[model samples]
Target: MGVASKLKDGFLSAFCLFLIGGAGFVVNVGQLLALVILPFDRHLFRSISTWLGSGFMIAGPFLLEDWGGCKFSAYGEQAPPDSKVLIVVNHGTDMDWAGGLSYLARLGEPFPGGAKAIAKDTLMYIPIFGWLTYFLEFMYVKRDWESDKKTLTKQANQLGTSRLPFYLCLFPEGTRKTPKKHAQSQEFCKKNGYPVLNNLLYPRFKAFTLIAMTMRDQIDGVIDATFAFEGEHPNMSKSLSRKLSCRCNLICQYHPMNELPEGEEELEEWLRNTWVKKDALLDEVLKDQEAFCSKQRKYEWKQEPLDYTKFFALVGVFCFFLVGLSVLMIVNKIIRRGVLVISVITWVAVVAALVINIRPSKVGEKKPDPETSSRRKKAD
Candidate 1:
């Protein structure tokens, strides 16, 4: 991409992120109000918040397509609305999760109980967007098994008892794929006598196992989804570049939970074996993109037009809140001044916190070796 084009794409992409984050901030405030008003009705509060949050998330796919010129195709049987699902996908690009979730949102119907994911704890610290995940009730883990186990266990228990259905997305690769990480993974596989994957990292089976065992009764099936780009490998930067021309494809295979092994040890073995098949499948698809595309069911984008109704509804809600706040300020000078002072202080505090906690990590920090890092608790 030319420098000028790249800058335009970057600007558009950043604006989209800011728009989504701002929308999420409104939704999150509504969720907090719901929690206070419906304290006794946990299910009602959860459902209200999740669906509201999803309205904001719906913009993700559209923005990606518009800014990046990316096209997506998915081949798989759609899961039933009432059925709970676990989506186990390869994490190739930073946009992979957003793309998949956006596809779900565009599926003509609402996602079951609104889709949630097991994401890295660091994501929870991100400003408005991160706080939105909390409203959606996404499970965030520290990537350490000991700490994550407790969190997942508690979450699973809650899910087991709840009547709402969910599609819990998990990235078994544990991190985004990089050439350096791929090389490290190959070496680790060689030492461990496991198959080396060219396009993916070795699957981390522990988190998958814990989730399956805990929610076995509730989960209907597991969806094995593989995402591939048509041209060069597209990381976050490349995907955001205006010159990006790669069409993305997602192939999903569903396996019933009952068909999986029941015992934990047996299940672990089964998962390893499944990853081997996934490796081979990805190899075939990547090797001959044309042949693979010709054989699979093509996803028709026409069937899933962006839902403008929901988009406008969200905007209307936000406007209503803004107007109400303005009216309150006009009627009460003391309250308005107090609110302005508090808002200023809050913004300063947030900026200071980000500078202290987040900025340093982005500079002069050495990343852990991929080979050994897999065994440590960390987020993808």
Candidate 2:
């Protein structure tokens, strides 16, 4: 890329990030106002919050697919619309889950409650994205059983009772793939007698098992999704510059939760066994990319023309909201103060959510492996 083009790309990416972050902050303040005036119902609040989050989530996918000209081809039967589901996906890049928004958008109407992710606890500290999503109520886990159990169980109980349709997305690998993590994962799996994966990390399955057990009867099924990118994986810079011609191939499989094994040990085994299959499935995807294009096509890669009409509509609404907020703030100084107050409140709430410890779990948490249990107990 030329120096001039690189500078242009940097400027555009910065502008987009600034615009989205500022606008999201304004919208979240509005969300706080709505919550204050509206009657409280957990299900109703969650559904509305998820819907709002989904709107912001579209920004990532739109930038990648519409602006950057990335292509996506997906396989497997679509999950039933308006049914609760748990999505178990392999994480390849930071942007992998961002691709999910585009894939789900193309699948038809979204779930009533849209999506809530199981995010690592540290993400809550990120500036604008973190503040905005706090209102959207994404579940955050510390990855420590002692700390995570109370939070997960409380959150799961709420989810289990909700009649609203939603997607609970989990990256069981806990982190994105890297050479060091992959090597450590192989070591962990080999020593523990679990299956070792080459192109993926061994899943941290204890949390998955707990949540699945907690919400077994409530959710419909689980979706195992694997994403493969054919060329350079586009980050924000590559995406803004349109410097890479990227095609992401996604494969999914649906497993009904009720059909899963009952015991914690059995369920953990089931999850491991499932990952073994996913590892081989990824092997197939990588092999296909390296081999003859016309090899027996197990998954017919469909390159449908991506219609930008809906995305444009979403952008229009976003612009309108920002404009309306500008007009309101200009007209009334009190409203401007209210915005600052909302920002302060957001910070306080974030701190509380981070430091406040929930009571010990009444929910039956699976005992950690003997070696790890001692460390967790000490941490507690």
Candidate 3:
């Protein structure tokens, strides 16, 4: 596709994704307010919010596939709906998680408890998307061993007690692989006498180790997924742009958790070894892309098309509640003036804060400290 065509497609796809996200944000705020005043089980409300919020978020990926002309192909056994899965994948592009989710949704069945990502704490602070993710109960880590250890433990305990089945998605590489980072990874590998990987960074074992130890009994399997895109070097913007024929090859290999080693140290070793095998697999694919693509096991999903009928209905209900709340506040004479004044002040404050926080950094500004950058990349 030409540059102009590509830009048009990208804009259209992004706009659609934004609309879906905006709807989700509205639903989240409405539900949160309801939970404060309504007499309902908090857990039940939380589950409902998560399901609705995730549904909204997942819609973006599917829409991207339809609108952006991105093709997805998956190879390997599909995780059963009842199973609690841990999805560990190499991080190459920002859209890796989105593409993975789209592929999973295409499977003939839905995951038992919906999937949640282990994101960086920074993501939880980004306006609408972040707020919605927080409402959905996604686990956000600071990437510091001292901090994340406690966070992961608490998350594990909560998941263990929850009735819903979950697919916990983790990117063990910790950050996206860039040329500079790749060089650093190769240097570390050489010093440690490990095979240098071209496509993947060395997997960080700390988070995986802690999670495995805490949730060993609860998880059913581990899905090791390697995502690759065709053509020249691909990144998030390119993936979303329809100018190039983007074909995503997602190879997923599922290993039963029971088959993995039990001891913490042994399990960490096993995980690292798995990454070595992944590097080898990526190398083989890179060497002969056509052969690898032709050999992948392809299956048609026999599921119904994604339905937004229920989502629209729920949105209407929330809108009605909000309208009623507004009317009630206005009709009460004693508090009406006070409420209006307070609402105006609150709106102004919120807008000012968002403007300051979302503003772009000045050109030629000094880069953030390494520690801050590291933490941001962990979440990115």
C-alpha RMSD between model 1 and the true structure: 6.1
lDDT of 2 by residue, 1-380 (tens): 79997789888766665555555555565566668534657666666566555556666666677677787767776667677888888877756766876676665444212667888766667655666666665688877789999999898887677676777888888777767668877987899887879888888777888889898888898998888777787565576665558887777788887778878889888878878898887787677775522342455545555444433454566678768978999999999899789878866774565343222221223345997988899999
Best by lDDT: 1
Candidate 1 local distance difference test against the native: 0.72
Q: 354, model 1: CA deviation in Å?
A: 9.9
Candidates 2 and 3 compared by TM-score, better number: 2
> What are the clashing pairs of model 2?
none
Report the C-alpha lDDT of model 3 over 4-91, residue by residue, as the tens digit.
9877867865665455545665667765775763355656766676566655655545544654456766676667666778889987
> What's the TM-score of each model vs. the native?
0.82, 0.78, 0.76
- Once superposed on the true structure, which residue ranges of model 3 sit more than 4 Å away at CA? 1-14, 37-42, 107-113, 232-235, 238-244, 298-380
Q: How many backbone clashes does every candidate have?
A: 1, 0, 2
- Badly placed stretches (over 4 Å) of model 1 are 1-11, 232-243, 298-302, 319-380
Taking every candidate in turn, the Cα RMSD to the unseen true structure, in Å, is 6.1, 7.4, 7.2
Question: lDDT (0-100) at residue 58 of candidate 3?
Answer: 55
